[model samples]
Structures are given as C-alpha cells and as structure tokens.
Target chain A: MKMKLRNFIILIIAVTFVSGGLFAQKKLTGLEIMKKVYNRPSPKEMEAKLTMTLISSSGSKRVRTIKQFIKDFGKVEKKIMFFLAPADVRNTSFMNWSYDDPNKDDDQWIYLPALKKVKRISSDSKGDYFMGSDFTYDDLGDRNPEEDNHKILRMEKVNGLDCYVIESTPKDEDYMYSKTITWVVKDRWYGVKKDFYDEDGEYLKTLTLKKAENIKGYWIIVTVEMFNKQKNHKTIMHLSDIKIDTGIPSRMFTERMMKRGL
Target chain B: MKKRFFTLIISLILIIWFGFADGLQITGYVRNYDGVLLNDDMDFSIVQNTLDLNFSMQTSKVGFKVNPYIYQYSDKTTVFDVREAYLDLFFNSFDLRIGKQQIIWGKADGVFITDIISPKDLTEFLLRDFEEIRMGVTAVKFDYYIGDNTFELVWVPVFSATKFPEQGSIWAVTPQFPIQPQFDFSRKDIKPSIKNSEIFAKYSVFSSAIDFEIMGGYTWDADPVIHTLKQIDPFTHQLLSLTAIPEHHRLTVAGGSFSTTLGPVVIRGEGAYYWGKYFQSEDPMLKEGVVEKDYLNYLLGADFTIKGIKFSTQFIQQYILDYDNFIVNNEVNNLMTFLARKDLLSGDTLHLELFSYFGLTDEDGLIRPKISYDITDGVNILLGANIFFGDKGMFGRFNKNDMVYVKIKYSF
Candidate 1:
C-alpha cells in the first residue's frame, strides 16, 4: 500500500511539471496575440475628461479640452464628446455609432455651436486628419483583424519590458497604410508602440503609449502620443478623472444629450 | 439713456455671475473688424468693434445659459443685444428648455429651407456669420429621446419679424420697379399676441447608415408681401406713381431633410412646401396686384475630401406652382454654391478657403476667398475679399459694396 501511494504521488508531480513546461515553451502566432489584444476585457461604459495637445516642430502648441462618454451595447457602440474649452468651440459636440456588422457603415454627426446646427458626416473620410490633428479619423477607430495579414517577426525588449514584434499588412492595396508594426507587451496583451508606413512604403507616423493603469479591474491606457513624420507634428492625448462602469444611461448617447451637455 | 441702462444691466449680471463659487463658467471674445471698398475712391466700408460674452451654470437637474453682446460702429454708437438666455430642465428620457433661444433644423448648408423657426437678420446682406444672421426667439422647447430617435416640439408665444437693412445703408437693396414706389408702412408690423405665435415640430432618426428629420410649422411669412396700388393721372389716364403696401401673412409649411453617405461622398437634401404664400403680380385687373401661390424650395448638396482638400457643392431651386407671366419672379429660380478648402502647415495653423454663389437664373454671382492664420492659442488673424459680379439680381445689387476686410479676434 505504501509503494502504490508513492508512485501515484510521483506521477502527479511529473504531469504538473510537464504541463507547465509545455505552456511556457509554447509560441503564439502574431494573429493570435493580436486577437487577444483586440478582445481584451473592457468596461461597459466610460466617462472622462480628455485634453488634446498639438505640438509643431517649431515648438508651437495648441490645446483643446473635451468631455467624453462611451457606451457599448451588444450590437453597437456609441460615443459622444463635447468641447468644453476654447471659447470659440465651446458647446460643440460630436457623436458616433459603430456597428458590429462588417457590411454596415458607421454613423457620425457634429454639432456646430456657432450655427446651432447638427450636421451628419460620412465615415469614409477616414484618411483625413481630425480637426487638424496629426491623428486621422481612421486612427481614432478600431481596425478589424480579418482585413490584415499578420506575421510574427521577432521578440524584443521595449522600454525594459519583453514584447512581441508583429507586422500587419492590409489586404487591400489601396488602404491608407501600407503596413503597421506593433510592439505588444508580453503578457499584458496591449500594444506599447506602433509604426505606420504610407502607401509609398515610407515611414509615416508612430503612436507611442505613455501610460496605462488598471482601473476597476480593466487595464486602460490613459495617455498616448501620435507623431506624424511628414508634418513633424505630434498630438498627445491625456485622460483625466476617468470613471468606468458608472451606469451611464443609454439615452446619454443621443443627440438630445449632446445638445444638453453636462 | 437706453444704451446706458443696457450697459448697467449687463454690468450687474456680470457682477452677480462672478459671485458664484462653483460651476459658474464665463467665456467670450473681443473682435475688431474693418473693411475697405474696392472702388476707385477706396473709402472705408465698415469699421466695427464687438464684445461678446457667455455665462453658463449647470447642476444635475437644471442648467442655464446667458449670451449677450455689444457692437460699436465707427460712428461711436453702441448696440446691445441678447442672443440667447435659456433655462433647461433635464429628465430621464426628456428635456425642457424655456426662454429666448436659437433653434436650428435641416440638413442643408448655408440655406434656410426647413430652418425657419428663427427669423433671419438680413441687415448685412447674408454676409454675416450664421450665428449672427439668426435672431433668437422666446419659446419653450421640448425634446423626447428614444433609442436612435427623437421628437422635438417648439412653441413661440410672440412674433419676431425679419430685420432688413435701413434705408440708405450700404446693404439696403431697393428693388428697381417700372416706377418709383411710395411704400405704405401702415400694416408692415406684426403685433405680438398669442394668435400670431408660431409652433414647430420635428421627428428625427439617426441610424447606422442614414440620418433624417421631418418637420412642419405654422408660422408667419419670413418676409412681407408687397401689394401694389397704381396711381393714375385723371386727364391723360397715365400712370403717375406706384404705392406699395407691405403686409405679413400666415402660412403653413412642411419639410424634411436627409443625409447619407456612399463611399467617401456625403449627400444631403432638404425641401419645404409653403402653402398660401402671396406673391407680387403686375396684373392691373387685380385689386391688390398680388396672387396667392404655393411654392417649393429644395437644396441638394454633396461633400467630398481628396488629397487633403475638401470640396462641397450645393444646388438650390425655388419653384412656384401654377406659373404665370404676370408674376415678377421666374417660374423656377436656381442657385448654386461651391466651397473648397485646404488646411496647410504643421498642426494646420494656416487655412485657405474659397466659397462662391452662382445665381443661374440671373447669371449673377458672388465669390469670397479667405485666408486665416492662427497667431497663437485663442487668437486668429483673417484677411478676405468679397467680390460681386453681374448687372442686377439678388447678389448683383450689392456689387458696389464689394470690399476687402480684415478681422482680428481674441477669445478667452
């Protein structure tokens, strides 16, 4: 009876060590790591104050303040933003609805405080920069993984942390970006830095994440910087007073809420 | 005394606004605008200074906003106006706003087809900014929001008429008639009463691929109708003078607008059918020298961006049903507007834009080309020119007022 018990204990230890070694030695493909990054757990709602600063190579700076809210339903995600500073643009608001269906187009609208008019805008102007910022409208949205071909290039250390270097090339030849290379953190499942190339295969821009924190059980990036190589301009986004899962009412995403701002 | 009293009231409001310790927001701008006519004389066309202020406060259940401005012309005369002062009450699924406010509706740009709730200020011949062109009205507005849909109702208990340029002003446009007319101003004013009030309603929906709104209004005509009375000499039976009596009339209007996108292009449309609108006629047999006709006004526009340049074009038409030669206006009036803009330089500190209006029916046009640079945060420098062409039409009548202007604005 004693011999049988010892053998059973030895078998159990062998299985655990073998499994742990297998998991540690396993290599993940670029697509799988990217999928994990895209599908990371997110809060159902978010509210925050955003400050966008645009800096030119000549050392000139322009700053804008905004109050933003975002909510995610099952099939659609809605976001609303109101300009809170720069007296000229005060009370101006914007709303967008993104659909999960690949065939559906997003809906967008902008309210001009000066004209007191709400204007519906097209989503296809993704290549155009937003409000003269270095970041294009496309950069502000999520890209579907199916549209790109991803390959794991190499593993490297970025900012004293181990990262997976992956390059994704768009399937469509006419896409604004030729290819994008990203440095995703080893286990945290988020991109720390990304490099973009233009259609001409020349370096166009870089987006660097400056800060990230665990808020309400979700890892959220609070600050990021996008630099345009062609214009030598950069836009830094800083988030403050962020609250998540605050039970933001679904009605808050409507135009009425935009006009009747907080 | 009136100007001083106005200033004193504004000062008091400012002082009271500053007393609040929390959540009281105050902002505005100070601007200097100067213009020079392009004629050989090169005389000054306009010299004005403006101070605009906005005060707002908000709590969880209620909020309020007050906007007042002052304009000082070159003659050292001052004019004070309150653009909007409103109180808001918020609820779970709805909201209520009361007091003087500006309400805008429609999908058209630079046109007022379904946007008729606020009377227009034509004092500057439509060259002023749209915010300055639309005069606010005292009203109660209710907005109920559903999932992706909204219902809005507006009630105005008083009447406000369009403001036209005074006689002898540079923007005053005198219609050239067969004979000089003596205007009878007896019935031109619309008395403020419940019977003369206006009501408007709209239903709007925003979806994954399209946005649209349908609206209807029971209101007074934005502009007055002229009834001509021919004066004749007794002996020769010859026409001596024409007397025009301008009067306001009630009308019903229904309109809707929609906007959609196809790839990179945005298409927009707006239309309104006005019922029982009076028009001028030359028929001497008619007692009032006018006819009642229903008209339709619509606008279609498209906007696209390519290679960092944005382009927009709109086609507008006014069609009077039951065409007649006696009517002064053509059976169909056409107008087109075009705009192209480019933002250049690092951080888009420089901007260039060209906008123009072409009157197809009259072959007249007006073009404005402007360039602006951001000198620093909250400060801007702008230089532009307004050029008009053609002999006579809506826009051509102001050809002599073509001018170059400079505006420097600093906001806080």
Candidate 2:
C-alpha cells in the first residue's frame, strides 16, 4: 500500500508539473483573439493566380481562372482581377477600392470586353454571392473586429491545429447571417474554419481552410472551400504562384487598366 | 505523287500560321436565334444563325482587335458585317485608337440620353442586341489620363449615318400621304470630307463622392428631315404629286452625366441640350413646313437590391423648348424603365430577368421577360417573350409583333 501510494504521488507530481509549467496556454477572451486576427500583418503588395471551381448539388463542375493584383496604401486597399480562362468571360476585368474608414463604402467597377465600356457598380452587394459561388462578396473581404460581439465558446482542435472556438454576432441585426462561429488557430492569427447561420438561427453554410503555406515568413492561405448546407453546393479556390511585396504599381488599379487586359 | 506534294504544302502552311497565331487571342460565339409571332398561329417570324468572332493581339505599346460577324437567315441569305477593327497605340499619359470602333457613353439603360457617339441601326426596330444595333465609326480617338480623371477627344473623318429599314419591309411604317410622294436622292448622301467631319470631346472624373462626365459635340444629325415643296394647279385648287427631299443638318450638343451611391441605393442622372434641332411641322402657315428649335433630353435612375434580387428604375424625358402647336413631337415627353433580376437553383445556374419600358407620353410600352440556364461551362440557353401594348403610339404600331424567342449560344 505504501509503495503504491508513493508511486501515485510521484506520478501526480509529474503530471502537475507538465500541465502547469510546460504546456500552459494563456487565457484570452474571444474578442482579443478576433482582434489579433483583424490586426494580422499582410503584404503591402501581392500578385496571385487563382483557379475557382464550383460544384453543384448534382455533382456538376465549372471552373474559372483569374490573375489578380493587390496593393495596400495605408488608407485604402486596391485590388484588380482579370479573368484568364473560360472563353465567355475571358478578358473581363474588375477593380475595387476598399477604404480603411468604416464609414466609407467600397468602390467597384467592371469592364465588359464586348461593349468596351467601364461601368461603376454599387458596393452594397456585399451580401450577394460572387460569380455563382457559395462565398458571398463579404466573405472575400475584411471585416472590422468591432462589427461583431465575440465570445469564446471553447478551446478545440481544427485541421490538426489547436484553435479557439468563438461565436461572433453582428452588431447590425439585419445582417445576412445571424451569427458566425469561427475556429481561430492559436498563435497563427488566422481562422481555419467558420460556420454561418441564417436569420432563423439555422445553419446555412460552412467555410473550411484546406491548405496553407508559410511564404517568405508570412502565412498565406493556399486553398479554401465554402459549402452551403441548405443548397448542397460548394466552391473551392486554389491560389498559386503567390508573389508578395512585389511593389505593384498603383496605376494597375485604374479604369484604364480594367479595360486593358493583361 | 501530286497529292502527296499538295498535302505536304498544306501542312507546312498550317504550321506557319499556327506559329504566328500563338500570340493571338481568339474568342467567339456561335448562336441560334428564333423568334415567333404569338398571334399568327405561332408562325415563325424570323430565324437566324450567327457566327461572331473576335481576334486580338496586344503588346506593351501597341495592340489591335478585329471583330467580324455573319448572320444567316432562313432564306439562305447571309450578311457579313465588320463590327469593329481598331489599332491602339499607348503612351505614357495618353492612348490613341484609330479605325472602326464603337464608343459607349452615359449610364442610362435601354435609352439613349447622352450616349450618342455612335449611330444606331433601326432595321429591326431595336429588337436586336445593343451591340448589333450600334454601328462603328471610323475615327481617331485620343484619351488622356490624369489621376482619376480622363479627357477624351474623338474625330470622325468620314460620316456614318444610322441604318434605317428598307422600304416595303415588315418593320417599315406604311404612311397615308395626301398624294403619291416622289423621292429625290440629290442630298441623300453626306460625302466624306474634312469639312463634313464630326468632333466630340468629353471630360470624366471619378471620385469617392461621385462619378461624373461632361461632354460636347459638333456633328450632323443622324436622322434626316423631309422638306416638302407645295405644288398646286394654277386654275384648279388641287394638290399635285409631292417631291420629298431628305437632308442632314449640323447639330451642336452639350451634355453631362453623374452617378453616386447612398448607402444601399445608387442614383444616376444624365442630360443633353441641343442648340440646333429641326422638327417636322404640319401647319400650312409655317414656311418650309419645318421649324428649328432647341431640344433637351435627360434621364434619372436608381438601383437597389432587396432579398437577393436587384432592381433598377429610370425616368426619362425629352423636351422641345418653345414648342409650337404644329410640332409633331410632344412638348414634354416622359418615359420610365424598370429592370429586375434574380438567380436561383444550385450554383445559381438558373436566372430570371424582367425589363420594361413605359412610354408615359404615348401610353405605349414593351415588356421583356426572360429565363436563362447555364448548361455547362460555355453553353447557355435563353427563352424570352416581348409583349408590346398601346393603342396608336411607337410600341402600339408593333402590337402585332408580340413574339416569343429562344436562343442557344456556345462560346469558346
């Protein structure tokens, strides 16, 4: 009995040391984690080639390719996308200027190759799906941390990485999604998975990060998939040939460049 | 041995052509379009097969594009059209384009308020696509860019007039003239000369607050006016055969357009004022039976989205200043347009759209409803209907032309 008790005490001590000293994690609020994600560092300039594949519920597939350029000017972030594949949309170009000021809405423009016209479009379509994809325009953009009320639901694991499971409710009651649950990877400063709920509080869609890479000391998302639970449709995006800090010219984001395809 | 030699020659030519074509980008579409009259036992009104092709090559400082289209009718008659063929030259702060090109302007939908750069083709009475209805002009266009602003100037060395329907065609309006009218062709054509050239200039600016454009043009009217010379018997007060003379006149115009967004709604406005305009007069007291006056055309529009559906509405007006009772055109003409679109089904492959134009002045309008389905990557099928309603106005004239159409298209 004495030997067994002594052995049990030593084992208990070892476990206590392991849990308290070696593997301890700093407790943080959900808002803090989301703030970290919102303030994550990004490249001043980036160029990427992306291929998007959309799959229907009946297992039909459609693919499109794009050559995209991005630049950050402290106060504004400008992006230009040129369609490079699919004959119908080939040479079609789109431009967007997203301002850092929360009060200022984004500006978008599209150039139709057939008409040779550049038209300004409303930016209020953030909640609308993009190019028939499961991902909404808001899903592809940045959201301020203050726009949501976040609470840490639990600590979990996602994609084999430790994550902070957080539930975020939008400040605007009439927003597209009633709430979104995100699995934020610990210390990586990025969300690996998210779940969206409709207004009735039923699950609507889910987004999962499939792959990522550490490029030039920067974490970059390589592939992602968005699945609509209600519609049984999904879209996958694979990003390739990512060049960071390439000093992209500001002139590349103009209406003239939208009409002049590369 | 001769056959072998010819095959080898053909293979060598193809190899050379493909080698040169590596730098060229080719895109085109093949479409089958059918239109049926609803009331004529669903009889086929028109059937057309189309092959539209576009080829382009671009470099850092130079580029060019060639667009050609062919339309074949049910009668085995084919019409070949060169839509646009242009060469582009790029500079540090400016670009120049020379050739047959189409320039689009303004923000109005289905209405031409300030978008008068290119003449239109009324052969089909606006039933054709806008791209097909607009005729390209051979001109030199220069665009200078400064930050978010652009200054454009276009010079047309040769005159290009609107394509009107031929006589005795189904689209022609049969008139009940007092006497059999004889036509004179002496002034029917505007000869190509520097003196007869047209010039247009525009300045556009894009800002966070709004997008706006200011423009001015000096050109000939695309439509001709008929000047009737009265003829009567000396002894008997009886009318004689009338000779109609159609002539184009100089027109001076100034216009501007603006677009802005307020929260979830977008607002657009466009207007143009003409200094010289000729109106047909039916009053016997007026000399020449025509009056020259100033004209105004304007449009106001708004677009919004609700429940994933996009909605757009517009109000347009055309005013003839100092209007006389004998003028054929109404002093104040009002028009309204509405468009709505939605996407449905998995991956949004199914689409629905409704567009309508309300001629408030004439109480005539056209309503178009369409359904589109994307079967595959580059294949699309569309089914649509055009309903015209009115008593005796523009659309009323086509009350019998209510049609149902289907279009199948393949792009590659």
Candidate 3:
C-alpha cells in the first residue's frame, strides 16, 4: 500500500512538470516571438528571377522581369537586380548594400544603358515605391525587430492555420505606416498575411503570401501579392528559378558588374 | 569608301555568326524628330529620322558588341554611321577590349571637366542628348581588378576631333570681325601621326559608402585652335588671302572625382587641372595667336529625391592660372545647372523634366523643359522646348536658335 502511494505521488509530479513546460512555451512574449521571426535561418547566397505584374483599377496591366542576386556578409547584406525584359528597360541594373547598423543608410546605385554610366543614388527614404511596384523599398529588405515595438494581440487561425496575431508600431513617428498587424504561422513561423495602416489609422495596403514552398529544408515564399487600397492598384510578384546557397562571389555585386549586366 | 564597305562586310559577318550563337541579343530603336525654330519666325525647320541597331554576344570568356546608326534628313539625304564596335576578352581578374568605343569619366552633369577622352558632336550643342553627342574613338582598353579597386589603361592610336555644326546650319557660328575685311578664307586641320598617340590611365576604388577615382591622360584637345595666316595687299593695305589652320595642341590632364551619400542627398565632386590649354583672346592684336594657359576646372553637385520628385544641382568653376591682361575675360568663370524630374500616372508612364544651365559670369543661360509619355511597352513620345537667355557668350549667341520639338521612339 505504501509503494502504491509513492507511485501515485510520482505520477502527480510528472503530470505537473509536463503541463507547466507547455504553459511556459505558450507564454512567450510578443517581442521574443518577433525576434525568432526576424532571426530565422536564411541562405547565405540566393539568386532568383521575379516577374512583377502591376494591375490598375481600370484593368490595365504592365509586366516587368527582373533577375536578383543576394549575398549576406554577416552584418552587411548586398543585392543586385538586373532588368531582363521590356526592351526599353533592358540592361538597366540596380545595386544596393544594406548595413545592420540602424544609423547607416543603404547605399544604392543605378546603371542606365542609354547613359552608359553608373549613377550613385540616394537611399534616404525607405517608403518610396520600388520600380513602380506596390511594394516599398523597405518591404523588399529585411527589417530589424528592434526598429519597432511588437505586442501579441491574440491567437487566431489564419486560412485555417493556427497563427499568432502580432501588432507592430514603428518607433519613429515619421515612418510611412502607423502600424502593421501580421499573422504568423505557429509551426512554420512564416508571415502569411499583413495589414498596414496609415498615420491616420486607416487601412493603406494589404500584403499576402499567396504561396510558399519548402525546398531543401528551407521555407521560401514563392508568390506574393500586395494591394494598395488607396489607389485601388495591385502588384503580384512571382518568384521562380530560385537557387539557394549557390556561393556567389562578392565581386559580382560591384558597379562594374552592374554595368556589365551579369 | 573601301573602309565603309569593309566595316559593313565585317558587321554582316558578325551578325551572321552571332545569329547562330547561343547567347546573342539584338536590340534597337527607331526615332523621328520634328523641330521648328520658334524664335526665327518659324522659317527654320528640322525633320530627321534615325534607326539604331545594337548587337551583342557573350560567352564565358569572350564578348562582342556593335552599334550602327542610320539617319535620314528631310533633304533626301541618308547617312550610315557606326557608334561603337568592340571585342572583349575576359580573364580571371582583368579584361581587354579592342575597337571603337566610348569612354566616360567624371560625375558632373551637362558639364565637361575630366570627361575628355571621347570627342563630341556639337551639331546641336547641349540640346542633343549626351549619349548622342558622344563620338566613339578607336582604342584598346584594359581593366584589372584588385579587391574593390580597379586599374584601367586606354590607348588610342588615332586622334579624332570634335565635329562642329555645318557652315549653313542653324547652329553654326559665323566668326564676326571688327571690320569687313575682303579676303579669301581657307581652313585646315592637323591629322594624327605616330607621335600624337593618346594614352590614359586611372585608378578607382569603390567602397560601401563612397567611390573615388584618380586619373591622368596625355591627349590632344578635342577642339582645335584656329591660327590665322593673313596676306595683305601691299598697295591698298587690304587683306588679299587668309588661311585659318585648326591645330590640335597637346594637353595633359590630371584629376580625380568622388561621390558619396550624405543623409538623403548624393554629393559628387570632380576637378581636373589641364596643362597647355588654348583660350581665345578677344584683343585684335592677339586674335591671330591662340593664347596657351594652364587652367583648373571643378564641379560640385548634389541630387536628392522627395515625394517622387528628383532634384539635382551642380556648380562649376574654371580658374585660369597666371591670368593675362590681354585675355579680356575674367580669370574665373562660373556656371550652375539645375535639373528636376517627376513622374505622373500610377505606373510612372508619364514623366516631366526640366534642365537648365546658367552662366554666372556672362549672365547667359539655357532652359530645356520636356515631357515624355510611354504609349506602350516599347514606344515613347516626347515633347520639349529649348530656350536661351543673355545677349553674349555661348547661350546668348544662340538666342535665335530657340526651338520646340517632338520626338517619337519605338524600341524592340
């Protein structure tokens, strides 16, 4: 009878420890969750071809084709984009170098075939649209979690997938958006959808990851769509021919390469 | 004529060769320009059409490019020209190019300070696009890379002179004299020889936030100095015959340029010190002799964009060392330029631009305002006007040449 009582106490202790551990995991703060989302494992080098389709409210459409290459250098990230289609913009290329330090602005350059020259450009405003697309320059780059304040609003299901709804407000009042609400999948840790509000607390744009795929242990967004509510315009981006960890050389990110359209 | 035929045959052979290659690309544009002189009582008109073809082929170790242009005028005249034709051989860390090419230097806009390698076509002055005005020269170029720095060397065996407007063209400059001297006028230009070959070298470093380059070159001035040789009649003290010889004098240029971003603005500066530069003297006694002087030219420019509008401004100055009293001009000349561009429409299909340059020393200026619209994927239409101000100097002398023009271009 004494042995039976001891077994009962042991059972009680095991149940309590297991339940407490699960509860602790669920109690993770919004900041900690966002840090995980921001620091997700990414490929050191990647190359991709993107097709952007711009749709107007009147049903007019324009298409652009771009080839992109990216490389991470620990605290610094370098990217180069080359326009491949639309005869008018063919051979035009853009290069950018982003630093991890918040005080340092990205360095950008553009090469115009007509001029046969590489022009250094200003990267002061991240809110400017990129290449006539619905996505701003900031949206195309990774944003540091420390730049904003995040709060876990609740737990909900997005597209039938369990998600943690988090709201982030920019620390700078002069930022382009007032706040953003994101729905991140619990298991995948992928941001499936996000809604941006203007300074007046009005819905400005909605960004949705239409499709994602798991390739070689990496989860990558294959298709994305952004809709601008104020302008009633939309941009759909389709990424294809993606290559990860290809070991691209650092020399390929130079101005000479930009001019060569390689 | 034989050279022309040979070039045509070679271009055809290359086209055929690259046509079957795996990575060959062919692109071009067709453009038409209709212009009318607004200040000339609408009597002067210009109608021209051009078709340009660009061919390129690239492999792992070699590349080739060629650009040919065909121009047609309203006077039933047609001309064929080759803009650039080059063959590139790539190495592990260096590349060599041979043939006719256009090389650009410096960071200033609408100004020439350190950009002196390629000759220019002054048929329409600054009204023409900069790319259109640049004329390629046959040369061999080599570029070697070291880390983020590059060393470039260029050699041009033949010298090319800048092309001026035709004698009867609206943009022509007729030399004015204080007296109506009755004499025969003749002009001659010096041709290039082995001793007059041009050479240039530059070292450039591009870093994360800044890029800078230092260059030096030995070449003949693109613009020739006119030397007057007059023969006067001994009996009437009248001029009998005059010969104007245009000579390309040797010049040495050493300069450097740097560009960096400061906050939201891009700041760029370029300066060059020219040795043995020829300047025109207004004094009658020295008119027949071109004065030689060493001068320093510099430019500072900045560009920024705000709310989808881009604004750029530049200040340029030229200082002549050891100023001569007989030069009859300021030792320092100043010029400024401002450019603005804005896009309209949701897709940025419509653009408006204004570019203006002012001569602070001479009180002369030029303002060009243009609007462009993309009708389709590869089709564009542009309308613009060139207006001039001042009563003297470069821009003022062309006051009567104010014009309004329309351009339509189709690319494929």
Question: Where does candidate 2 chain B have its weakest 10-residue lDDT segment?
Answer: B168-177
Q: Comparing candidate 1 with candidate 2, which one achieves the higher TM-score?
A: 2
Against the reference, the lDDT scores of all candidates come to: 0.83, 0.82, 0.81
For model 3, what is the alpha-carbon lDDT of residue A12?
7
DockQ, candidate 1, vs. native dimer: 0.49
**Every model: iRMSD:** 1.7, 1.4, 1.4
Stronger candidate by DockQ (2 vs 3): 2
* Candidate 2 accuracy as lDDT: 0.82
Q: Tens digits of per-residue lDDT for model 2 on B291-354?
A: 8999999999999898889999999999999998988778998999999999987767799999
Clashing pairs for model 1 are none
Model 3 per-residue lDDT tens digits across residues B46-140: 78899999889877688889999988998746979999999999887998989999988878887888888889989878777888889999999
Q: Every prediction's TM-score for the first chain?
A: 0.89, 0.89, 0.88
Extract clashing residue pairs from model 2.
none
DockQ scores of the candidates: 0.49, 0.50, 0.49
Error of 2 at B189 (Å): 0.8
